[model samples]
Target: ACLSRLELSALKFISGLNSGLISGLNLGEEKIMSEKIRFSVVCVCLILSFAVMPSGAAYAKRELRGKIYMVGEKDEDIPSKNTTIRIEESDDSDVSTDTAAFRLFIKDHYKTDETVTLKVEKPGYQIWQPVAGKVRIPANLENYHEKVRLDKLGSHRFMSNQAFAMLIENAARESTKTVSKSDEKPDLSRYLKEWAVKYGFGIDDVKTEMDKWAADIEKRQDNLYELGLAAFYRKNFKEADEKFIDMANLPVDWAQTQYNLADTYFAMEDWAKAAECYKNVLKVYPNYKKAIERLKLIREKR
Candidate 1:
């Protein structure tokens, strides 16, 4: 008789956890011992498989298959042409797509209880990796399936410097507001000094609200970076440049920020400055293909 999905799952789970138990069991005992005792031993083993084996263990033993989708602002599907998908530990090879969707089949690449990392990359789209780039196939089954989505990269990539500056400015403004209770107050310095003596924006209060705000921005620079990119997408180059510069000044080694700055300079027709910025990016990341191409273009223009 053909095994059902549930039976297959249960058998896979039992085999993974108690392979020794199955191997040790004696089917010959049915003839040697009483039929009742042989039946009881079989019942015990079956119970142990279900009781001790973890839920979803059967699923992990199976092959994994999935489809990729690109999503837009309204969660609408977009064409995913030229997208690349890669799986760790399976192979270093990548699969590319020419349409809005791509099918993935990973067979015999993973074992029960093992995790696999799936990475998807495409130009002009934010990369997607589930659960910090890893997913564990359940050990109980023979097959698994999933659907993945990728979001487009907008102005958020361009506006990091502007975002950080705004965050800092906002922090200072909020601090000032706390000091001056009134909405219409021009003399913020006087109020800050007075409030600092009592509530402490001063050096002594290590756990002050201002200090918390400062630390918060420092910890969440990525969020600020995204905001800056949003500004850049909005054609606010001045703000975007300011945010990118601020981010770079944070001593974060982000080649993309430098590259974006170069792109901004190029947009403004400052060929010399753009060329310098692109060269800086290549200096840090010698294999940055886009920067290499842009640098060549700038030099040709010069």
Candidate 2:
């Protein structure tokens, strides 16, 4: 009997035996040859499977990159001069205890042990750098808006604060000088009174200096409030109050200035003025929480 299995290769072998004569081939020999052919086919299939197996390179992760900025500020990628911002991962489920190093990771293909140096510049500001030779980004760097504060060097480099301070001081000084040179002395008593009341400057102290030259009452008010706001942000509440109160009569920036004035009143425990300021705040921002609460408390006490 002929081999039951379809051994096409074995049949080729038999046919290549000088002539196409399968009839004379022994059934036992044909069956053995067919088995070898089937085994060879299985081997070929296995080889193909191994050749196309998936690789680890297909699933590798890529690096990330982006610029960092301070809260409520903008700067270009060319290092912000006065800023030292750090990038950090958004997920804080895992924490670390590295105080000296910042936990910001900027994925610019920064390999471990790689040293990178770049300058951070800001307009009218100075550049700053990471403490060590390298900027170490925390492993978990996929999340969160990290805070970057001004270092000592950063402050010295970015002279915005100093510049602003000098501007105010100069204006005060120059106004006095101009008054001395002017043909007519300006009535600076109002300006001095407002400055004292707004910035908590004992009006009596500056009264003589202010009276020395007729001051530009309105211009002086602006300068005082601007300085006072800067001082307020710096936590000098006494100075802030003086500035806000002196410019109270000016029509511009009334709402915010009044609101800030109210805050100072609340801080000083002048409840009556505080209540009045709160009322004014409501007229501007009806839903201001602090003002609303303070106003309500003032009414309750009455």
Candidate 3:
């Protein structure tokens, strides 16, 4: 009985050992699965960061900037004695956002070659379209003054001595000080003529050149109509009619001025008159469609 009991105990011990081994293997597999899941999550986060962040950083580093200004009658005629002009880079037309206006007015005048697009707006004046202009900054102007302009929302690409000199020269030319507040119609046509003269072209010369272009357009249209008309008179009714119809609105007195008259008669189905007219159109247009069509139709009718 003792020996049987010992055997039973030994069998139980072996069974327990086998169960523990199986449990340990299952635990190792679970740990490996968890590690793989953690690694995959880390890889996804790294890819997303590289995809979105660098482009934004590059844009921040290299964004473009510029300045703005308003033109008036006189240099001193600045719109407001106390009001500073605002400069900004914007696709918007609103000038109320003139946070950069002050930067435009430092040292009694300043200039910028970095083409400024300025939107001029005031309490009573109409909101104007943004104008493309350059600004000049002054040499004596301190960074502090520039900051004041920046406070008004004036933006800048770079500050320089040349810009300041330009501002001074510009201010001396025409300031809003000389302009009056009234409904005045400036002679824009006269101004354009004057500008043409300034650019070394006389007004009459410009007009003459324009007339030449107009004549050329007319001549081309006439040539096309004639080509079509010639085909028509040759009994090429289809081509002739197409040419005549194509020139429906072109202004040209025919070479003989009688060919189209004949064509008109033929198109109206007046066979006798169409034949005569077609003959006449051919005299002038030589290739008028109506004459050919009328001659054929008349023969058929007869």
Candidate 4:
């Protein structure tokens, strides 16, 4: 069976956990991780326990020690091994080229939500990711592991998340058919050609404009929510408020977004605005425990 991107990533996640590459929390195991890496994981876990995840509820941060891979038509063989990855603004390629894995000063980046700019530059290839989220340094072990998806240079957009989903759905619906060796091969070019007729340019063009897919403010609901969450985890509470408030005013019934805005406000100790937002969350989800508890705490403060 040909797995889709999500399925492939899930397999990688499980593999990482088994191999001790899942760098989420470090119980100070010296044999498993370096001292700096251990501290970084501890910081991330502490933040999760106090602020975001609340017993690892949702948000998480982890280091990036994975390979750079190609977003080719083939789902099974994704990694573009030996393709050198250089961190942004650096002039040198990594000395180790076998794994296509670049080293980062991960101890610093993993503990905070700082944006790390990256690009994939092989002489004849480029990046094409449409539904790609911004990757913070170090893959999020709690969430799906991220692959630095690179692809061959083309006017045609290869393996867009849209077309990938279509391919996966089509494969599933045809699963009962007689098996053939020829059917096992992935044909990514067909989807690329199809989407090229519709969207004009590849998702990010050649510059690796990281927010190319996210620049459209009219389709801003999910973007703003993620931005708020990122800022909140970074402890940039003021910036988090700005993003969350913008998200809250949008025409959507997102109780969690309202609850997040309330959480941000309470973090700032703005009791009135926090109370107002918690009430907004209750209007949508009346029995949400976190919101209910926060509102009561605010009332007690008053």
Tell me the tens digit of each residue's lDDT in model 3 across 1-302. 33344344544554454455455457777567556555654565556555545575344321122232333434222223333244454433322224333333222222422343343444323212121233233233333221111111121211122222222223323332343665432222343354234334566654454344334534555344444433422335466557657666443465345555655765676777666655544433433333555676777985
TM-scores for every candidate against the unseen true structure = 0.28, 0.20, 0.23, 0.32
Give the number of the best model, judged by lDDT: 1
Rate residue 277 of model 4 by lDDT. Answer: 88
TM-score of 2: 0.20
Greater-TM-score candidate between 1 and 4: 4
Error of 4 at 6 (Å): 56
Model 4, 3-105: lDDT tens digits are 5454455555555554565456456554455544456545555554454334543333233555667665654437676666555543324522466565433
Question: lDDT of candidate 4?
Answer: 0.51
Give the candidates in order of lDDT, highest first: 1, 4, 2, 3
- Which of the two candidates, 1 or 3, achieves a greater lDDT against the reference? 1
Distance (Å) between predicted and true CA of 101, model 3? 5.1
How much lDDT does candidate 2 score? 0.45
* C-alpha local distance difference test of each model: 0.53, 0.45, 0.40, 0.51
Superposition-based RMSD of candidate 1 using all C-alpha atoms, in angstroms: 21.4
lDDT of 1 by residue, 1-302 (tens): 45445556655665454544454557775334445444654565667657766788545433455556777667676656666776766654345456444444456756655666677776655433232245566654434555566655432221233223333334444644565455443232443344334221352342244344444545665444443444443435467567666655654356667788999999998998898788667534433446756877888988
Off by over 4 Å in 2: 1-54, 58-67, 71-111, 118-133, 137-154, 157-302
